[model samples]
Structures are given as C-alpha cells and as structure tokens.
Target: MIILGIDPGIADTGFGVISAEKSTFKAITYGTIKTSKADDLAKRLDYLYKDIEKLIKKHKPSKIGIESIFFAKNAKTAITIAHARGICLLAAQQAKAQIHEYTPLQIKQALTGYGAADKNQIQQMVKTILNLKEIPKPDDAADALACAICCAQTKQYV
Candidate 1:
C-alpha cells in the first residue's frame, strides 16, 4: 500500500511517499514544495492547492496522512500552515485517498514510542524505520515520513 504524508506550511510544505507491506516500509520519494515569501497569502494558497493536486495525480497514493495543527509559537504562522493543510486535504479528497490526521504527539509516540520525543529523535527514528542510509533532509520531509509511518503502523490497511 502506498501512503502519502504531508507536513504543511505556507512557505514549505513537505511531502513523503512510502510503500508499506506488512511490517516493513519502503521509502519512495520525498520533498518539499516551496513558495516564495514574496507571494501573497492568497497566491501561496492557490499555488499549494495546485501543487498538491499535481502531487496526488503523480503519486496515486492509496492513503494520505497529515499532521494536525499543534501548539505553535505564533498564531499567524499556525493559520498560514492551516491554509496549506486545507489544500492538502482537498487534494486528498479529490483523489479519493483515505485521509487520516495525527497530532505531533501521536506521530512522535508512534515513531519513537515517546510522545515527547524531540525532532532529532523523530528524524533518527524515521531514518531507522525506513532503513535509509541517511536521515531524510529538510526536516519537513522527515516529519512527513514519520506521519506516513504513524499511519501505516495503525489499523490494518485494506
């Protein structure tokens, strides 16, 4: 089964694709969609919407795992990220992918068995779980993979 994971941000939306078979997961492709800060919020959102749709078309994932809004230091930052997340959700729905949301705590616990695991710990766990030679870069991508792993580890996939 193929699962697409997303770590949404207005400026950098991270995406990771993983193929899961039974207890093992294979890393597929992962990257971030970056939008310029110069772009207005509306334009950025539209860009994200189109880009996410294109990604769904290209990957044809069976499921989507997205990180939910968690504690943020800045309200504006959180709201902007939420906009990007909404686009991801719309793309997933349009592509008929089963959508699941996990909080940062849930993702952390699922990947590292510690709900309060730090970013470095989660990244290392993501690397270890996917059996990759190196940790996925750009942090966002690694987080996305962690989201995918969280989804895969839960309830049996049909």
Candidate 2:
C-alpha cells in the first residue's frame, strides 16, 4: 500500500509518501511545501492546493493519512492551520484515496510505544523504522512520515 501523509500549515505544509508491504514500510519521498512569506494567506493557500493536487496525481497513493488538528494556544494559528488541513483533505477526496486521520498522541504511540513521547523520540523511531541514516529534515516532514508509519502499523488491526 502506498500512503501519503500530510502535516498541514499555511506557510510550510509537510508531505511524506511511503509504501508498505507485509508490515514493512519504505519511505518514497518526503518534503515541505513552502509558501513565500510575502504572499498573502489566500495566495499561499492557493499555491498549497495546486501543489498538493499535483503531488497526488504524480504519486497516485492508495490512501492518505493526515494528522488531526491539535488545539493551539493561539486561536488564529489554529484557524489558519485548519483551513490548510481542509484543502489537503479535499485534495485527497478528489483523488479518491482512502483517508485516515490520526492524532499526535496516536502517532507517537504507534511509532515509539509511548503516547507522550517527545518529538525527538518520535523522530528517532521514524528513522529506525525506515532504516534511514538520519531523521527527515524539518520537524513537520518527520511528523508527516510518522503519521504514515502510524497508519501502516494500525492498518491490520483496523
């Protein structure tokens, strides 16, 4: 199964693609979609939408796993992230891929066997699970890959 995982944000949306077979997961591609700071919020979102659509078309993933929105102390940041996440979900729906959502706690637990695992612990697990030399760059991209790993791990039980 090919799974695309997304960690959405207005400025830097993270994306990771992985292929899973027989309980083994391999990272295909991972990166961040960055929008210029000079661009307005609407323009940034438009860029994100188009880029995500292209990514979906190119990868043709069987499913998409995205991190659920976690409440933030800054309501404005949370609202903006919610909008970005909505567009990502829409892109997955349009591509007709099965969509799965996981929380940060769930992803950490799946990857590290600890629900309250720190970011470094999760990154280390992601690196070890995929047999990569180092953690993927940009914390968001690592988190996105972790989300994909979580989905791959839970697929059998679900």
Number of clashes recorded per candidate? 0, 0
Q: Rate the local accuracy (lDDT) of all candidates.
A: 0.91, 0.91
Which digits, one per residue and each the tens of the lDDT, describe model 1 over residues 1-158? Answer: 99999999998889999999999999999989999899899999889889889888888989899999987789987887788889899889989899999999999989988998999999999999999999999999999999999999978445
Error of 1 at 23 (Å): 0.8
Best by lDDT: 1
**Candidate 2 CA-lDDT value:** 0.91
Q: Distance from true position, residue 26, model 2, in Å?
A: 0.7
lDDT of candidate 1 vs native? Answer: 0.91
Error in Å for residue 22 of model 1: 0.3
lDDT of 1 at 92: 95
- Pull out the clashing pairs in model 2: none
Task: Show model 1 residue runs off by greater than 4 Å.
Answer: 156-158
Q: Against the hidden reference, what TM-scores do the models get?
A: 0.95, 0.96
